[model samples]
Structures are given as structure tokens and as C-alpha cells.
Target chain A: MKNALQTVLALLGEDYDSILQAWLETQKAEGVRRPDLFSDRESRRQLGDILRGLGEGISRSDLSEGIALDADSWTDLRATLDEVTQERVERGVSPSEMATFILAMKQPVFARLRERLAADPTRLIEEITQFSRVVDALAMHTNEHFIEARDQVIERQRAEMMELSTPVVQLWDRVLTIPLIGTLDSMRAQEVMENLLNAIVEHSAEVVIVDITGVRVVDTQVAQHLLRTAAAVRLMGAEAIISGISPKIAQTMVELGVDVGEVTTRPTIRAALAHAFRRVGFSIEKVENARG
Target chain B: MADTASVYLVEHVLLVAIPDNITDTEIMSLQEELSTRIVSDGARGVVIDIAALEIVDTFVGRVLAQLSSMARLLAAETFVVGMRPAVAMTLVELGMDLHGSRTALTLSHALRALRSEGLA
Candidate 1:
């Protein structure tokens, strides 16, 4: 009797078209194959590539191991799955949807194997077990790749958001401002300090206003982060003004007995700017309309 | 080898630029040189620029702190200027205090700050 792996490979070679047709039918029936996001022609081409790739490597792939996708013989198959995974992830396809392409093949392959090995009940069961193992491992590999691709995108977006949130804008010739949003964690506070110091050096800024208007929480850790940034700014010879303290955050700070040290804190950005202007030897006056 | 990179006198302010690869012996001699110059030239202010220095270890930090206090005894104020962000973070991490030493963004800013304090 041919071994289960060989039997499955034989069925893959002889009944390729039938198996492909059955797999696509089950996918369509189960709503796994999204026609709206992927064209029917492209879907067939992708499925054909994966099926051919499997046939090419399934012989060398050890059915006993849980993961055959990592085998050297299955490099081409892995590449095909990776391409499919990337495309689907970009298309906003869910993990289940990405895995279904590999999973739906189980029904077609199992059905064909059962038909061929019907006279030998024990061999038919063995082939079914071996085939399920291969398909399950492939499904997991596809899901892992999909999640990794999505994670990469998430990591990139997070970095961009961080850099975007900590902008140090020059408010005056010798004054700079950084309007901070979100929580002032250690990492973010460090970034803010770096940016503030760089701006002070770049603009020879004598004073910096850190507006925390968008930040809601004022725990001790955040207060410490703010103080550290202020100290760093001072170390660069520029003063730091912690601005935009709401009544609630003020109450929290007072209750927590958070000492902001010698660094200045203002109630609002306008007030901070005024204080900064005074420190930098500048003044702002509202001009009356000439029409008067 | 050359003590420090350069030293310039602007009015009562002494502008000293420190190189990245300064040796420990050179730093000690440089501090001595600065102390004598403060007394002999009647220099009322000192600006130590470390923009060229990439690393500021605890030893360097302690010496800077001491240098400022030493200058103060001689009736001269010290300001460390042009400290890179990395060095500042490292100093803050090490919890090094400059005592009465002030910091400035540049040599020019340090001079201005000292002048405001009536150095000139």
C-alpha cells in the first residue's frame, strides 16, 4: 500500500482540476472567497499557484511534523503563501479569511482520497489524518505571516505618530513651543526633551512652553516625566514652562503633592507665551484698527 | 594633546571649546589653566563649549561641576554651552549637579547671560 503522503501527492497530480474546482466551490459557498475584494480571475490564478506549489513540495514535506511549510523543499510554496498573505492583509482581509484559502482545500482532498482508498478502510483513515496535518500547518503558516505583516504596518504607524505628536515649533526668535498630546510616558517624555533641547540649540531659544492641553491624566509618573523634560531643557540653558493645567489636573497635582521643582508652570498657552516673551525680552501688544 | 581645541577671550568672558577626544590629564591641566586665566586676565565669565564632545562620563560631569564651583571662588561665573542632547540626557541620568554653573545654548548665549549678570 502507498503511504498516506504519497497517496495524497498522487491525487494532487492526477485530479488537480477537480480538486481546484471543488475547493473554489466550497470557498464560494462558505463566503470565504470575497468576490468584491478579489476578482474571480485573480482568485483562480492565486489558487492555481498555491495548488501547484503544494504538488511540487508535498512529497519532500514530512507529514509527521506539525509544520511542513518551513521545509527547504517548500520554499516556493512558502513564497506563494507569503505573497497571498501580503495582498490579503493590504486588502483588509481578516485572518480567518486568509486561512480559509488553505483550509477549504481539506474537503476536496479528503473527499478524493476517501473515494480512492474506499476498499481499504484503515489506509483511507491514515491518508485523511496525514492530509489534515499538512493543510492545518499550511493554514497556521498563512495566518502567522498575515499577522506579522499587519504587525509591521502597526509598528511603522506607531513610530510615525510618535514623531508627529512631539513637534517643537519655533514660537519666537528666542522661544520655542511643543504642544504635547496623549500620555507623557517615559519614552514620549524623553523624545519631547530631545526635541526641546534640539530646538533650543537650533533657535537659541531662551524659553520653551510645553502645552499639555491635550493630555488628560496627571499621575505621578507623568508629572515626573514633565519634570525630567523641564530639567533637560534647563540643562541646555533654556527655560521650560509647563502649560495647560486644567482645574481637575491642578487638583490632582495638589492632592498628589507633586513638586514641579523650580520649573515654571502656567495655566494656559497664552499665559505661558507671555511668560516666555518676558524671559526672552519680547512683548506683544494688540494693535487698534487704523479705521478708527 | 593640544590641551583643548581652542580658547578665545571676549571681553570678560572666556570661550573654551572642548574636543571629543580629550584626555583626563588634559582636562586637569585645562581646569588649572582656566583658574589662573580667570585671576590673571580678570575674566569674570567662562563658557565651556562641549558640542564637539559626544560622550560625557560621570568623571567629566563631576569635573565640570567642580570647575564651575572653582571659578565661583575666584569671583568668576561658569556656563557650560552647546551640550548635545545625548550628553545632557546622560548627565541627567547620572544625576550630576553643576552647583551654581548655568547652561546656555551657545557660546554667544552664554556670553549674553553672563553680561546680564553684570560680568561686562
Candidate 2:
């Protein structure tokens, strides 16, 4: 009976029911025998051969049974079986045994079937699971790549802006001269104010000379920013001196009604320094050093 | 608008020549362009030529002060030139600080001022 069952299983391709029944019968025959052989790779391999011998019809039946497994149960079973197969592989199991172990692992077997069908792909239930996994992995990889690239670009921009904003030299003991060249917007204005305030605190400057001969025109918002900056400087116990006023900017200021009365204006940094020096009780005079 | 206007670059002075009837947009654009140029070229100072200005209002005065501060950040000096008597008086009447911030009477005076102050 055991031989017959083995022959039938080999011919039928180890359909789950046949394999389960044969193992049960073998246990009955052996009286106090353990059922551990059912899970053994060699035993599974022999059973697989028996089922395969049962021809194409038996193989179809096995396939149908696999499809009949509940989706959730099938997933759990596949995960457990794959873990076991991985453990076996790590233990250096023989290739043949590994193959049988992998075959018993539903995930790998399903993956192979999916690959075969994907070449001529269909919307079958099994194919859906495989496709979803591939999509999920691709999405995760893409999101990670995008975030990394975005962060790198932001870091680079921040560094560049900082370099552009750094002040290089101080012109006087109580007066610090900063040359501004570029369009002044709200963000840049804020940066300028912050930098100036910090410098004023650091140097204890009484006057801040701002030369803007490079500026072509002044808008209302920009005018407001400057007023705010001047106010901020005053609050910090320092004076803000504005040096450059283009005719175009002057006209705009008049039209816009922006007032800058509290701040001092100079035509150039030289004048601004002179004014600052005089304000601090120092005058520029020609120095003559004679040692001839 | 005139394609070209007289430009006088006094030694050590920034001369910004503007077109007649300078509009708000033009003023804003000029400020942005000049600021960028100052920072890029590391200009020491500038003198703005406002000889063509017929009206000096509050907004325009405010803008002038703003531009001066911006130029200062770039290590360049700013000077307002060609302030007409009427405009100056109007500015003063409006309580505007045209003289309080960086401003000049003429392009040459601005240059001389820059030179004298050692910021030329």
C-alpha cells in the first residue's frame, strides 16, 4: 500500500492532499513513527517526484488547489516557508535539498510562475500580488532618491547665499562700511539687517555706512525694508547712514511717500565717514610726517 | 523713454543716470540691477545723478535711503546728486531726510566727498 501510494504520488506530482494522505499512511504503518519526515526536504522531494509522475492532469489539480488557498493564509504560509528556506540556505543545505525547500516555499514558487506569466502578462489574482510588490519597491526607491536630491540642492543653495552675504572688511573703528551690490528684496533685506545688527554688536559700531551707488532704483517695499533696518539699527544703539540715492530712486521715493528722516544720507562712503567722524568729534586733515 | 542720456562718472563717485519721468517700476528695477552690480564688481562707492528729477516725494526719498543701505552692504558708497532746490525744500517740508541719508549736490561734489573721506 505504501509503495502504491508512493507510485501514485510520484505520478500525480505531489498534490497537497495526496502528499498529506501518504505521509499519514506511512505514520500509521510505522506505529509510533514521528511526522517530522513530512517537513524534511528529501521526503518532500520524493513526494514531488511522485506527484509529477502522475502526469499533466495531476499537476493541474495541484495548481488548482494552490489557487484555492485563502489569500491571507497563503501570504502567511509563503512568508513562513521562505524564512525556513533562507535558514536552510544559510546552513549550507545541498542544492537539491535547497531546491525542494524553495519549492515548498510558496513565495518563490509564486514568483517564478509570475515571471513566466509576466512575459505574456495577465491580470490574474496571483499576478496582482507580484506586480503590487514591484510597484511598492519602485515607489519607495524613487521617494528616497527625490528626498536626497532635494536636500542636497537646498544645502548647496544655503551655502551659496551665506557666502554672498558675508561682510569682508570694516572701514572705521566706530563706523563699519558695507558695500551692497544687487537687487534688494525682502529676504536679502532681512539678511542684511541681521548681518548689520550682528556686526554692530560685535564692533560696537556707532554708525553703519551703506553705499548704494550700485542701486539703480528703489521700490516701495524695498524702501520700507530699509526704513525697518534703520529703525532696527537705532534700536541697537547705532546709526544707519544711507549713501547712494539715484535720481530714479529719489523720484520713486517721492511718489511712494516713504519717509527716511531719522536715517542719515551721504552721497558717498567718503562723505559718510567724514560725517561720522565729525559726529564723533574727529575731522579728516592732511597729515604731514617730516623726518628729513 | 530716451535710449541714452548724459552720464558723468566723477572720479571716485557713482553716477547713476536715469531717464526722464522715471517711473516706480523703473526705480525698482534700477535699484535691483545696481545692487547686483555693486556686489558683483565690489564697487567702492557710487553717486546717483538726479539732475533730471523735477519732483522729490516721500516714497522716492525713502527709496533713496534704502538703496544707500543696500550699496553699503556691498562695500560700495552711495550718493544722491542733482537735488533741485524745490525738491530739497519739499523733502524738508515733508520732513523727509534727504540730507540725513547719503545724498550729494552734484556728481563732482559726490566724487570729491568720496575721495576726501578715503572711501573713493
Clash count, candidate 1: 0
Q: Give one clash count per candidate, in the order shown.
A: 0, 71
Q: Residues A1-292, candidate 2, lDDT per residue (tens digit)?
A: 2221222224234345544445434433543122343354544553344223223322223332223222442343333333434344344444444333323323333444454455544433444453334323323333343445446657888878765754624777777866777777777776677777667657767678877776655788878767766655653445778877766777778899988776788767778888889765677777699456
Lowest lDDT block of 10, candidate 1 chain A: A60-69
Q: Tell me each candidate's i-RMS in Å.
A: 1.3, 12.8
Off-target runs (Cα >4 Å) in candidate 2 are: A1-147, A166-169, A285-292, B1-120
> What TM-score does the predicted chain A of each candidate obtain versus native chain A?
0.78, 0.46
True contacts kept of each: 0.58, 0.00
lDDT (10s digit) by residue, model 1, range A1-292: 3344787889889998888889999899878899988998888888999999988877765656554567798999999999988888888888888788779999988888888988988988877887788788889999999999999989998999999999999988888899999888888988888888777777888889999999968899999888878877888888889999998899999899999878899999999999988887888878888566
Q: TM-score of predicted model 2?
A: 0.36
Best by TM-score: 1
Best prediction by lDDT = 1
Candidate 2, residues B1-120, lDDT tens digits: the string is 223433333443455876558777678777877776675555678777766777867777777778888878777877776655445445544656543346543565567668888977
TM-score, per-candidate, Cα-based: 0.82, 0.36
